[model samples]
Target: MQSSRFVIGVIGGAAAVVAVGALGTHLLSGTQSTTGLDAHSTVTVDGHKALSGDIVAGRAQSRYHPLPWVGDKVSDVICPTGLKAVAGATVTCTGHRSDGSTVSIPVSVVKASADSVTWKFERS
Candidate 1:
């Protein structure tokens, strides 16, 4: 009977040690992590938003590509035909105004800063 009690006590102590170690490791590792858009977006330059009166500059390929123009909200606004808008790539975005007029605009993805990409717009 005494031997059985000793074995059980030893097992319990080992389990307690393991649990403590796991908790300690988890606490040391930390639980705070980046989430949402900040998790997927990357910034390669400085600044979050563009300054006023920034000129749009860049070049696009000849082959036409589909680029979606999202509204202020995440809803689908328009799908414009142009080059794919990538980091440091120039693309064209054609959108329709509320006045029933179509407008083709040149867009440039200059750089991303602080989880946001800077864009320049020009009339075409």
Candidate 2:
């Protein structure tokens, strides 16, 4: 019947509109892609960019290893207690140098992988 044809046409039109909307959303979201980073890499943290260094794995658990620096040179870094290195988490890590000086680096987790986590440093 003509009514059946009309109902089918309406459904098809609605499906087309939904498909177009989904495609548009995907295209727009692609512009916000992130800068890829991994473990043992250097990223900016609170104006002081440094390497992520190694992770301290103890009893089947893993965490970012603390860094050690010599004088003005960059070295190890440590995040505060309870601030996990998961994606979207913000943490302030203290950079330790050999000369007994410490610097605070504000970092935000961007991506967390199986073996490493990437962070973006925030400017003070």
Candidate 3:
């Protein structure tokens, strides 16, 4: 009977540890959106930090040098606002994974089309 009680106590302790671990992960995760981007918007490349003029669904890529990953995590490339951004214009976006980490990036913009901006994952 004593041995059975000891075994049960060990199991209970293990379960408690697991619960604490899960709670810690939830608290440490950064706050970012996993939802896809809008149909029309500007892109910011972390590599070059260049903000090109507005682009449409089908357009040439602007200048940028990509690093692929930052601090071991995929980062969202962003262009600093300046060219013609104004208040109420959501030129800035915060991207991330389901846990709120940067995993995707917007390499270009397609104002009124379905064009996808390229991130040029491979650096030349």
Candidate 4:
């Protein structure tokens, strides 16, 4: 995580108000973890259970939507197929930015069960 400082100044008649604020930033460059993800939308890849690429991409897009700088800039997310849902499984998704550039989003599976799976976004 990174930190940034912002200053807001309000000037009025004979009075001045200045506010300083600090925010911890993720900026799509930090690790974000999520748990208990629904595993219903899954498939079998080489006899192993795997999450759907489309579903993972959609979920990743939703996760990126709330980010500060890269949220609004991302137009779409594309993940590779056959992402195993087992523990320690990893994949790198691509985020297409509005400016025609691409961002790499690495993901790792933390846990997996019949009903749910937990995954985390690796720091870029």
Best by TM-score: 4
Better of 3 and 4 by lDDT: 4
Best by lDDT: 4
Lowest lDDT 10-mer window, candidate 1? 57-66
Q: Kindly list the per-residue Cα lDDT of model 2 for residues 1-124, writing each as its tens digit.
A: 9999999999999999999977765553321123324434445445543334223111001122111211133346555432234677665656654577766656565666544555555322
The C-alpha stretches of model 1 lying farther than 4 A from their native spots are: 1-87
Residue 117 error, candidate 2, Å: 4.1
TM-scores for all predictions: 0.30, 0.31, 0.35, 0.63
Compared with the true structure, model 1 gives a TM-score of 0.30
Report how far off residue 48 is in candidate 4 (Å). Answer: 0.8
> RMSDs, each prediction?
17.1, 16.1, 13.3, 8.7
- lDDT (CA) for every model shown? 0.39, 0.46, 0.34, 0.65
lDDT of 4 by residue, 32-110 (tens): 5454435557777778787877777777767665556545545578887746868888888888766788888787788
> Ranking by lDDT, best first?
4, 2, 1, 3
Candidates 2 and 4, the one with greater lDDT: 4
Which candidate do you rate higher for lDDT, 1 or 2?
A: 2
Question: Can you write out model 1's per-residue Cα lDDT over 24-88, one digit (the tens) per residue?
Answer: 65554331222112332332223333321111211211111112222211111232432222456
lDDT of 2: 0.46
